[model samples]
Target: MQDNGPSLVCAPPAADARSGIVLGEDALTVADAARFAREPGDVPIAIGEDAALRMDASVAARDRLILMRRPIYGVTTGFGDSARFHLSPEKTTELQRNLIKYHLNGTGPSAPVDVVRAAMLVRANCLARGYSGIRRGVVELIVDCLRHGITPVIPERGSVGASGDLVPLCYLADLLMGSGTARVDGEPVPAAVALRSRGLDPVAFEAKEGLALINGTSFMSGFGVLAVHDAEGLCAVADLGTALAAEALMGNRSHFEPVIHRQKPHPGQVRSAARVRALVRGSDLCLDTPQVLEANPDVDGLGVIPLGRPIQDRYSVRCAPHVNGVLADTLDWVRRWLDIEINSTNDNPLFDFATGRVHNGGNFYGGHVGQAMDSLKLAVASVGDLLDRQLAMLVDTKFNHGLPPNLVRRVDPGDPAAGLHHGFKGMQIAASALAAEALKLTNPATAFSRSTEAHNQDKVSMGTIAARDARSVVELVTEIAAIHLLAGCQAADLRGAHLLGLGTRTGYEVIRDHVPFVDHDRRLDEDLGVVVGLIRSGALVAALRPHWDADV
Candidate 1:
């Protein structure tokens, strides 16, 4: 037999060459998960030195129970409705193996690689809490797969968010045991082959190891964390968009004044208003309603009082904070919930080594996650709907003040494409379509929850579905925001970018770097893609956030 040097499977993440996040050592934030989940290679993952010891204690506690012949769910007895069917001591391994094998019936397309990686990281973090009776070796197997850039082909569907994410996570169990499929550079390949290529062998499941592996809210919480991160960024960019729209429409700046929002003072609304003010600081484009009213006071019998511009912007421009703020507030609670869920010991029939007792409970139920994501879907779609409306007003000549129809720019009036040009017209329609789809998905997935796996598993939390739906809404809304941003940038070009504020001017330049000014009618789908990428990557928000450091 030829030697392949060291087995990548058993290599310690701590021993890896890069500085990175330590699971079980500290609380994992959404920011940490985002950095690692997107590119696992950039940030290495390591288990804390004490994490293995904790797993050892859990295993020992479980061993003492089995030695005494005491009954336990899924360990000494059958699962779900068959909890009454006790098995012989020798069948413990088979019980765990059957748990993984049967749930392999997960239906749906394989999840994206980033999602799979995030799920794996979250699951490992849960087991690291060391209440799941997982062996140190099984935890290492998961870490090894991540370190070697091998992600399982877990299905996106299945799992009722109770009894853990059993079906989808079963694929993870299969890869750990070397049976199912894994993605090798985004292409499907046999798990065994992938493992062997990395100079590793498939793990043999222990008594409660399979139950430990598949029993948690890893999939739901993992995807939830990512969605929440994007939603948060989108909130910031929405403020930036509001600033640009206010300038483009020559709308009233009084609408975003600190004194006005201070009266109502919802934390999100206050902060959003402050962010917009900071972004629009030193701008000459937006109107001051007080100045307009004072300068044009009626002199002859309450004459028409021609102030020229409208006294206030439309709701989409004026109430942007109110729309985006709801999601911002939603994230305030959602982040805390997800942090708890991911760091939780969600295992059923948990072993407490400190007290030498076994406690059975339903910690695997993801009710909090379901409600958070359901609310996230609603709040996020509202932002998209608002942006869609903003885009609507931007493209219409009647509402856009003095801007050309559809924001069409005729550099050479007689250059032949004069009336032929229809700039930003198609992008507006696409934004509307995206906003509609996003609104449709907001019909709470949790509201339609149904029973599954017999009457024993009644009242399941459809949190996984809700999380997936939230992710879809975020993606759709991101595209919608992208279109709004592109249109807002075009509006800036029409209204004179030189008149933009310090923050919006900086924002416009950054966008113009990626997408040039639309001079003529051309293929815009690619431009939309580029801008969408910028939004999701958080680069756009990063460029504009520093200017808001003091204000928000």
Candidate 2:
């Protein structure tokens, strides 16, 4: 359905929010889902009339099959092991209700409200494809729940990522019937109470409605959408971080030369090199190695500079493009895969309109998402490693060129607080600890597969867990990025602000706007928080968006 109709007034408080995205049998990109998920106000959603009509047609086909007693799966028969048991037509409603009730076994802390909302939106989109045999009224209720801020309190655990995300989805199904808990305006309450407060009614399960609502990959897809979005933002910020670190270390920009990159021509590497070049352009802090060598050549005339100030920068300073470039490429790949998954119809017994038959199969397996998330975790953790290494370099006198030890401003030796004032010493340690945690979370989710549901659902994909792990990894890495930004700015200050590149100079000023130069040691917790907020808020990335366009 084309999403161009007037939206229903689902909630007065949220009524004036952005106009709803119409859920039809069309593409719902990952970026689109992320935007809708992160909307500050409740973004309204509407069912497309064309989608409703298509769904009505599929519903009619299901009704015909039921009247013929064609013995369809999940419609006339029980689910899973009970698929062998045929049910009478009168028991169809009970069968659907029982399907949801039995699968309400999810257990863990509640998923974030945004994740829940995204999941609902994804599921609604899947149903709108008109292949799930669900009625338009059911789709409206899903949209109503999201618009009125009625998010189901879904648990974080359960589900093998095969046969759909059944456990959490059952909670969603339970909420539709007003039998579970929900969050309204960020407060937990009975689902029925929340719905009633919004002038809404609960729905009773019909023939295929229960199965249609619960049988899909919405939970995993929702997490993937947000994770991919954040990963993209992180890559941009990582570029800023690398630029700041490069300038602070007085590292040579020779490594980012196009001549060196053209030989490899990896798209991500070329892009990363370009961003670093742009970010560090016009920076006086970077070493002019060619000029230095020209002025002081070796006595043997090998075209080499004298062995002073070291011939080259350390690996952390020189190999940043190689490290961050791979991460950039990985994020781009995962985004493409998520774009396909978010728009896909991942439910079983799909109604094939052209063939006029229910094609029952395992289109719901989340192996692709599982692998993408696993790959994402590894890449994000590597970013943590890169940032950690750079932070360590910034604090140490041995590798920081001529910067003061621990990045402390050179104080009077006779001053009483000379040795006591340790600048960025504690901040570097905190960054290290966070990097360690992030690296430890790189375990692959596909390695933890388990058999469940009477062996009928054995060897299921642990994609949800993988996606959650990737989220945690992203969080830790963001903190690490914050620490790097803080330390890099401090190092830049010691080196002289006038020496910084155009983009890095602007970034340095942005950091100092919230946090001042550390003349003496002070509590850095608040400073770290402000920087992290800036990163997560996308402000830092946006400030340098022009510099990052090449990387994107």
Every candidate's lDDT:
0.85, 0.82
Candidate achieving the largest TM-score = 1
What ranges in model 1 sit over 4 Å off?
1-19, 294-299, 302-307, 411-415
Tens-place lDDT per residue, model 2, 1-552, is 323224311211212235556676455677778878887354556766667776877787777777877778889988876788887778899998999998888898899988888899899988887778888888889888888888899998988888879889999999999998999978999999999999999999888899888888889988888888888888878888888888888777787888888898877778778888888989887766785465444668566544654546677767777877888889888988877776567887776554467778886788888899999999989988998998998888888878888899887899887898889999889999999998899989878889887887888888888888898899999999998999888888888988899888888888888999989878999998999999888888788877656644
Models 1 onward score TM values of 0.94, 0.93
- Screening candidate 1 with a backbone cut-off below 3 angstroms (N, C-alpha, C), the clashing residue pairs are none
Give the CA lDDT, 0 to 100, for residue 414 in model 2.
96
**Model 1 reaches what TM-score against the true structure?**
0.94
Q: Which candidate comes out best when scored by lDDT?
A: 1
Candidate 1 residue lDDT tens string, 1-552: 111122211222432335676665436667777667887688877887666677788899888888888788889998889989988778899899899988988888878888888889989988986788888889988999988888899888888888879999899999988898887767788999999989878988877889888888899887898899889988888888888988898888888999999898889998999999999988888867787565555657875656565677789988888887888888899989887888788878888877778899999888889999999989999999988898888889889888888899945677777788899889888888999999999998888778777888789889999999999999999999888989999999888999999999988998999999899889998988998899888888889988999987
